[model samples]
Target: MKKTITFLTVLLVSINMYAQENLDLLTYAHTQDINFFNSIKNGTQVKEYITVSKNSVKIGDTLILGTPTSEEMSIRTYSGSYGTKARGGVAQSRSTSKKTYEFIQMGRPAGFGSIMAAMNGDAASMADNSLKNTTVIVNEIKTYHRGSKNKPLYVVMVLGELNGKAFGINKYLSVMDTELAVESGEILLKNRKMTRDEAIAKLKEAKELMGIDMMSKEDFEALKKELAPIITYKNQE
Candidate 1:
């Protein structure tokens, strides 16, 4: 019985060590993510603007706006006979091919009033409306390095309020905010690693703060699952 107890104690120690190692790794990753996010938030210092159309705005939704110069391309093909009629009499062959390219404008930022009008289905009346541009409070910024190292795509979420309601919107901006805009506003930006318990508590607070019930059930579940791993160690501790 004494030998069994000794072995159990050793096993328990091993498990504890393993758990600690995992916790350490998680803390490191969390810290890295937070740091990267802050670098994007704090690194750049210009305030540029883009024009968004009235049709695609949502209230209480975070808006991700790209610069004014992004373009989307579409390729189309057409087929036809160019050769002379090849009836046995003409003795001619026929070949057919055609291609077309269409370029669409994308990533344009919209004025706050236009967005609000679009959301309210009053875009027509607001077509010539002149409203001062509202400032966007950026919350998070991420970048994707595609192909060229110099020109990476930026993903950003900004805090916006319209019609007296506040919410977050995520947008893919061609230019990083840090590259073009200075951070403004009083949103608390997380800059340090959080303990599992603290992280879980923050998640609960965010849910209530964001009106989780207003989000689709699927989205709420997915958000919970995404944060679950970070907080999973809470119960074990």
Candidate 2:
């Protein structure tokens, strides 16, 4: 009787602890929806990212960079931004521009290596060159906001070299946020000129996100509308 009671108590405690781990994360994704296959059939698009799980990732893990577009979800988290210092994240514009510089998020990096040094200083403004059209292999993955929140918004903040020059990057953790940052080997078209299969794959990814509550139905619908024109491109599916 004593042994059984001890085992039950331990099991309950372990389950509770596991639940707490997901709570530590703060994402706009509601993560409750479950419909996945239909979205692909309906024609979405594919966005590849390295899957990030608290259980699998560790400090000092290396993340390869990718090309970044305005549509990319990886919002840049700087030291002084309200998003960086506060709980949750800072407000970001959907169609970001050079004027705002508010969310200098990235998809892929250019060849510039001063991303970190400039970001670490006062009144730092990122130049267009900071986002060079190049890829890199970096060796830093430290927590961004390690205060009341232990996880760093699921984005990768890396510090490594570009031709022996050090740089820094902080962005949202959507697909391709980093090469090894999430599920690998999936590719999504950045714009409207995607192949038939690519378009379907991308929408499928969005649908899955909505099902899991990671995305809202409204956004998913918007994506469908956005890609509607492509469904009838030359090479019909």
**Candidate 2 structure quality by residue, lDDT tens digits, 30-80:** 111123221111111122222222113323333343333323123453443
Per-residue lDDT over 1-237 for candidate 1, one digit per residue giving the tens place of the 0 to 100 score: 687557556644532331221110111122235443233322222122211110111123233322223222335543443467433433343554322111111121233433344456652121010111333343322332222323333322234434434422322111223222212211112232344556678677767856856566566677778777767654331
Which has the greatest lDDT? 2
Candidate closest to the true structure, highest TM-score: 2
Q: Please provide the root mean square deviation of candidate 2 (C-alpha atoms, Å).
A: 19.2
Q: Model 2 residue 105 lDDT?
A: 31
Clashes within 3 Å, all models in order: 10, 35
